[model samples]
Target chain A: MQPFLPVYAPLSDQQIKHIEDMADQVLAEVGVILQDDPISHEAMAAVGARIESDKVFTKGDDLRALIAQAPRQFTWYGQSPECDVVIGEKPLYAPTYGPPVVETHDENRHQATMADYEALVLLCDRSELLGTTGSLLTIPHDVPEEARPIAMARAHLEHSKKPMCGSIISEQALRDVAHEVGTDPSKCHLMHMINTTPPLVIQPNPLRCLRAAVELGQGNMVASYMMMGATAPVSIMGALAQGLAEIMVGLALTQIYRPGAPVVGGLFATPFEMQQMGPMFGSPQSQLVQIAGAQLVRRLGVPCRGDGMLSSSKLNDAQAGYEGAITLAASQLCQADFILHSIGWSEFGRSYNFDKCLADEALILSSI
Target chain B: MQPFLPVYAPLSDQQIKHIEDMADQVLAEVGVILQDDPISHEAMAAVGARIESDKVFTKGDDLRALIAQAPRQFTWYGQSPECDVVIGEKPLYAPTYGPPVVETHDENRHQATMADYEALVLLCDRSELLGTTGSLLTIPHDVPEEARPIAMARAHLEHSKKPMCGSIISEQALRDVAHEVGTDPSKCHLMHMINTTPPLVIQPNPLRCLRAAVELGQGNMVASYMMMGATAPVSIMGALAQGLAEIMVGLALTQIYRPGAPVVGGLFATPFEMQQMGPMFGSPQSQLVQIAGAQLVRRLGVPCRGDGMLSSSKLNDAQAGYEGAITLAASQLCQADFILHSIGWSEFGRSYNFDKCLADEALILSSI
Candidate 1:
């Protein structure tokens, strides 16, 4: 993969600095609400953070300093030698990470079964564009809830030799996947996705996932799916500040757990359509926040994870095409290091269509 | 309308200079073939350009000198006062200029009727994005070939008060439309599109159309639709040079016929796919040529006409969406002033769909 060169940055350096300063202020004043996580609170306290009840406050410098200890780039290994992937070299594409439903070309959506999950794995394996058979292609309704994580990992191991994301469901579940795959901890075999709750908060489950993955010398991705005017602020600047502050807190956790942990920062913002009461992707404001915020993420000296080929359209029609194309182009414009959900995402990431996946990857192939 | 600022220029100053040098060399050496056009030959000789049979040769400096007299920007007046469009200020969108086939949302294609042509006129009038009524939305199969151009112009005048393209089929047809609409030439009420046959040639018919429009103080657009590796040189630099030279010869004619005439330069190049034996849109090479070539056209001191929302896809699917979005984004990136074929174009500009038009425009809305 050739290195991505940013060509469509809309914000000035002064504007970026202004947003960064706001993020710093948010971290210093409002603080992140840590939910009943003593280990996280203790880690923050050890790093000289101010804590009250469930709120943990740290200066931006403290967070940045902790984040600085994390490696800016690293390599992830698969069972196969050719499957090794360099995280920050260029735009690395992965399939849809989370979707509960599958939409076919004929326009029928159904609960994604285990077969559908395995099919996506094979599709990614066959694709020339995608590197990893992404983690959590969809939730498998067929698998028993308790045994699902391990079964998913087993599918990854048996189906293909490509790198996959370990389950962040539980510390034990993730540990079992590592053992099942027999992957070396020294070679960062997995990138555990840890989603953050917005408005300056991180759940304890994801916190535990981050710590477990970091301690094992694996990659941990901190991401927030924000809907402006809803979960996030209406203004791009306000949303960016909150988004940046949220991600920084999560990044700080990786270094606090273990220095030099491989980590990626993702802040995906889509404007909330007031009339529809849902997220709207591929808007100009969405593009602005993505390009500007990714620049902010890079300032912290780490790889920024990008969301790609996302659309609210149910069918793989023109709406899906434009939305996917526009969003994907924003990733390239900002030169986002690791692109997640690069293909096969539709209905606002609710349903994955096989045809849309092929069509989107073709678009990506044409663009870059 | 907001003035567009170019943001995605990929060519370096040296590279632009190299292409310019190549264009200059081509014009001085190969020359443009002006077939059976005695008046054009006389105009070229008057400008001290060398002429041999149908070939007209002039130095790049000589061509640039003549082209410098054309207006860089102008106000095009519609019948309604609110419909005034300032060319070169921002992107002024228009509908599909030419397509003989019409495809509907139900996935059916048929020969375009007079009803389809008029429907497109009304669509453009209803559109908030599109400024002009556009030239030829589609060829009317019901209308006689000889009377089609005047019939199209009449539909634009009768349906909407928007500024529209004058008939360029002949010198008399254009004059008839100006008189029928009762439009004053001083206000630049029309922009006539005159297509250039590729491989450095402009047929006499279009030359006559260009001359008639320029004589009446109306705008003239000299555009070439070239397929690289077939009608044009395989290399982007080589294609760009040939494109610029072809356009310069036409732009120079506008000055020789009537100095300070408003003109636009369009050089649309799509790569020729070997297996398909047709032009492919949305390719990275297509974007580079569009952006770099538009910059070269801007250097000639006229508004660069852009072809937008173009695709070779047969359906209003993801392929169409990506291709249209990518191409439209290129126009915005290069800040092309007058955007033609901005919506409803499909199947390599041979088919137009109502659903695709609305969908493409929505994509543009989400983008800018």
Candidate 2:
């Protein structure tokens, strides 16, 4: 991993001040509503917030200000002069592999392997992408459960020069990976997802993952994916606000544990088919709401992340292109600071279709 | 506008070296065909290239390697937290406005003004945009021609904290406004439009303006805006590639003068109206071609720029939204690093429509 990552649209001194004030107001008055996770709830309470079941409230102005202190733009190193890319201050393009990793040199979804990781690097290098995800799209097969994080980090450091972000299954994994990446446990930017359980509640594992990522000094790209009319409110905006609340509460918790902690807020919401019980992408409204969520996060003056080449109907066909284009277009228009799943993505984050990834890279590159 | 604003994709060190070698081969064997203006021809001749009329043929590899040297990203300054945005490395959002000079303000069709600029700042702040163009559509009544650039730059600097791209009009206007805003000329990202002069020709003034901007050390964002079937080839891709070629020649000239200059290559091609003898933005092919052009530019590896809220219809209505969304969506999806006519734009960059700009911002923000 590179020693540093680049940032864009830096905040002014006044903006920083405003964010601090807002954070305090949110912490003191608004407070956060955590799910039914007593451990996280206790952690929030320990950090000077009042706890009421899953709800945690306190003044977090200082925390907001500190996180807001994260520079708007900075340099993230690449392999050399040619590979170096500035992310925030400029538009950076990265291609991603879709879900259900394909075995290297074969057709079949399986756990990711080192060869898959290497293929990703070569593809990213060959394509127009400024970076690669190391072992993107959930490389479950490559490493043992206990050693996954460290293995992934080492792969990135050894195989690629561009910046990469992803999750570690556990705290030990996070620590091991942090050591391998040489990032301060508290300042790393690892990706994680947060979803509502039945009836709009965050699950324990993801909840703990969110807090742990932040507490350890690694930035959390907290994704709040709400399926409208299922685990979330029926309306897209309603679902968006709810998702925002979940991520914000988690982010607020991290900032409290350690002020000035780096964190990125994100949303991965879409529509759900009641009859089929399937998630739907390509809904214009779904994309709209996701973009709106991105704006809402940015409004809070924090870096926001989003996916671009997202598709629900697993095939890498016209549906993928149309949905991916719409999704990528919406987020880019909304000026998402960081984009995950920008390329080689399809089938609801399953199946890394090479052609689709290449096409998506073209789309992502065009947007920047 | 350094001597050369080479458009290039991010390449591995080996690839860069390979391209450099290729460039050397081209420089010594196959060469570039420099067509158009005599000044450029003369400039190439001085560089030891063969000239035919306005055409200059050079060894291809030298130019290729020179272009490969361009930095993948650079910093752009913003006025406030709301407006702070970047281009080059990542896609940045900017707003469009109605043309105040030609249009009147109303509930639906609002004219642009200083107040409109202020409103734009608020909306831009609320939304996720990288930078802004003052008067989004065009506040002709708000500021005199002499003062337009200053007013726009000043508003962006004062109201928002985002990096801004320089305005169009005249070279002197650019310098004057840069002075007014106390911006260093070297850091400015200047913009201009190139219209096809029917069949195959280039106008002198806009060309001069582009060259002047480049000479001043300001970044150039050039667009070839064609009204298809009338001003350009009927096929959208044909028009797109031709338009890209037109700009590339000019861009190549910039590089010849200054190596590794910051430049954005862009295309804005729309279908033409036979009866009205103008252009229409409602066509979907224009949007698709725009997306394709973005791919081409990134394939070439220079920063890509284009428009969003552009329309040729004289009014702001559903046609506007549909067309604007399509175009803007393409722009964002293509990951255009810098976007002009992104907000408050209407009638194909002819007037200021604040309401339309506002709606575009809202829609774009909420877009997926």
The number of the candidate with the highest DockQ is 1
User: Compared with the true structure, what per-residue lDDT tens digits does model 2 show for residues B173-238?
Assistant: 666755666665566544444333433344555556666666666666655777788876797545
lDDT of 1 by residue, B137-226 (tens): 889999998888778888998999888888887888888887777767677898888888888999989988898888788888898878
Give the range of the ten consecutive residues with the poorest summed lDDT in model 2 chain A: A1-10
Candidate 1 stretches with Cα past 4 Å from truth are A1-6, A103-109, B1-6, B103-109
Per-model lDDT = 0.84, 0.58
Best candidate (score: lDDT): 1
* lDDT (Cα) of model 1: 0.84
Model 2 misplacement above 4 A: A1-39, A46-48, A57-87, A94-98, A103-112, A132-136, A140-143, A184-200, B1-285, B288-368
Q: In candidate 1, list every pair of residues with a backbone clash.
A: none
